[model samples]
Target: MTELVRLTGVSKRYETTGPPALDEVSVEVGTGAAVAVMGPSGSGKSTLLNLVGGLDRPTSGTVEVAGEDLGRLSEKRLAVFRRTHVGIVFQFFHLLDDLTVRDNVLLPAQLAGVPPRTARARATELMDALGLGEKANAYPARLSGGQRQRVAIARALVNRPALLLADEPTGAVDARTGAQVTEILRELNRDGQTLLLVTHDRAMADRCAGRVVELSDGRVVASTPAGVSS
Candidate 1:
C-alpha cells in the first residue's frame, strides 16, 4: 500500500525555555490503514494530529500527507487542502449548537464550493448512513453524546476525504458510546479512508489495524503493532 502520511524528524516547540512538544518524531501511515497513536496527556499526540491535518507547521523537519508537504504550503493553500483532502474529528464534537444537524454536516461541502443542492443531498446521504436521518433537523444540544459524535462523524465524512484525523474522538463519552464510535471509525477505514487516531484508550488503540506509537516526555518510547502492548 502507498504511504498516506509521512513525518520525517518532525519537531515543534512552543517556548524557548521549555522542551519541544514533538521531539524528532517520524512515522508513516499507509493508505486505508487505521493507525493509533497512544500516549499520556501532553505527550504531543494532539500536535501530531494537527500537523497531519495541516492545522500547524512544524518548527523543524517535515510533515507530508497525501504526497503534499504541509510545511511547504501557504496558509491559503493549506486551507484549501484541508477542506478538500483531510477530515478532522475533535473530542468535543465541534458542531454548531444553533445549526440543524444537516446544516452542520454540510458546512464542509459548502465551504469547498459544492453547490447548496448537492451538498444538501450529500449531507442527507451521510446522515442516513450514520443512522441520523431522523435527526437531520434537530439541534445538536438535543442529541445524546453518542448521537452528537455520530453527527460529527457524518460531518467529517461529508466531503469524502482521503485522510481522517481523529483526536481523542471518544474522550467525552462513555465506554459504550466510545465503542460505538470506534466501530464506526473502523467501518470507515474498512471502506478505504486512511485513519490516524490520537488517543489514550488502550482498548481503542488495541482495535486499530496499523501500529501504535507510545510517547513519553515528548519522545517515542515504543512503537508496536496492534495486539502487542506498548
Candidate 2:
C-alpha cells in the first residue's frame, strides 16, 4: 500500500526546560490502513495527532502527509493543507449548535471551496452511509450522542480527506453508542478510508485498527498488531 502519513524523529516541547511531549518518535500509516495510538494521559498521544493533523507543528524532525512535509509548510499553507488533506474528529463533537446536521457536515467542504452542489452530494452520501440520512434536517440538540458523532465523522469526511484522525471517539458516549461508533469506524476503514485514532479504549483499538502503537512518557514503547498483547 502507498504511504499516507510519515513522522520521522518527531518531538514537541511546550516548556523549554521540561521533557518533550513527543520524544524522537517515528511512525507511518499507509493508504487504506488504520492504526491506533494508545497511551495514558500525558503520554503524547494527542500531541502526536495534533502534529499529524497540522494543528500543531513539531519542534524537531518531520511530519509528512500525502507527500507534503508539514514542518515545511507556511502557517497559511498549513491551514490550507489541513483543509484539503486531513480530517479530524475531536473527542467532543464540535458541530455548530445552530447548524443542521447537513450543514454541519458540509462545513468542511465549504471551507475547502468545494462546489456547493458537490458538497451537498458528498454530505448527503456520507450521512446516508452513516445512517444519519433522516437526521439531516435535525439540529445537533435533537440528536443523541452517537448521532452527533456520526455527524462529526461525516463532516470529517466531507472533503474526502486522505486521513481521518479521531481523538477518543467514544469517550463521551454510552456503551451501546460507543459500540455503534466503533462499528461505523470499522466500516469506514473497510471501505478504504485511512484512519488514525488516539484512544484509551482498548476494545476500540482492537476493533478498529490493524496495528497499535503504545507510548509512555512521551516515547513509543511498543508497536504491535491489534488484539496482540503489547
Candidate 3:
C-alpha cells in the first residue's frame, strides 16, 4: 500500500519547561487504510490527529501528509492543504443549528469555492449514501445525536478529501448510536477512505480500523492488527 501519512520522531511540547505531549513518536498510515490511535487522556492521541490534520504543528520532528511536509508549509499553504486534502470530524458534532442538514454538509464545499450546483449535488449524494436523505431539510436541533454525527461525516467528505481524521467520533453518542457510527466508518473504510481515528473506545477501534496504535504517557507502546489487545 502507498503511504499517505508519516510522522518521524515527532514530539510536541506546549510549554518550554514541561514534558512533551508526544515523545519521538513514529507512525505511518497507508492509503486506503483505517488506523486507530487509542489511549487514555493526555496520551497524545488527539495531538497526533491534530498534527496530521494540519490543525497544529509539532515542536520537533516532521509530519508528512499526502506527500507534503506540514512543517515546511506556510500558514496560508497549510490552510489550503487542509481544505483540499484533509477532513476532520470532532467528538462533538459541530453542526450549525441554524443550517439544515444539507446546508451544513454543503458549507465546506462552498468555502472551498465549489460551484453551487456541484456542491449541492455532492451534498445530496453523500446525505443519501449516509441515510440522511430525508433529514436534509431538517435542522440539527431536530436530529438525534447519531444523525448529527452522520451529517458531520457527510460534511467532512463533501470535498473528497484524501484523509479523514476522526477524534473520538462516538464519544457523545449512546451505545446503539455509536455502533451505527462504527458501522458507517467501517463501511467507509471498506469503500477506500483512508481514516485516522483517535478514540479510546476499544470496540469502535476494533470494528472500524484494521490496525491499532496504542499510546501511553505520550509515547507509542504498541502497534498491532485489529482485535489485538492494544
Quote each prediction's TM-score: 0.97, 0.98, 0.98
- Candidate 1 per-residue C-alpha lDDT over 8-87 given as tens digits, one digit per residue, 9 for 90 to 100: 99999988778999999998999988889988899999998998999999999999998999999999999999998898
For model 1, the run of ten residues with the poorest summed lDDT: 208-217
lDDT of 2: 0.94
Clashing pairs in 1: none
List residue ranges in candidate 3 displaced over 4 A. Answer: none
Of 1 and 3, the candidate ranking higher by lDDT: 3
Q: List clash counts for every candidate, in order.
A: 0, 0, 0
Residue-wise C-alpha lDDT for candidate 3, range 41-96, written one tens digit per residue? 98999999999999999999999999999999999999999988998999999889
Tell me model 1's lDDT, rounded to 2 decimals. Answer: 0.90
CA error at residue 193 for candidate 1, angstroms: 1.1
Q: Compared to the true structure, candidate 3 yields what TM-score?
A: 0.98
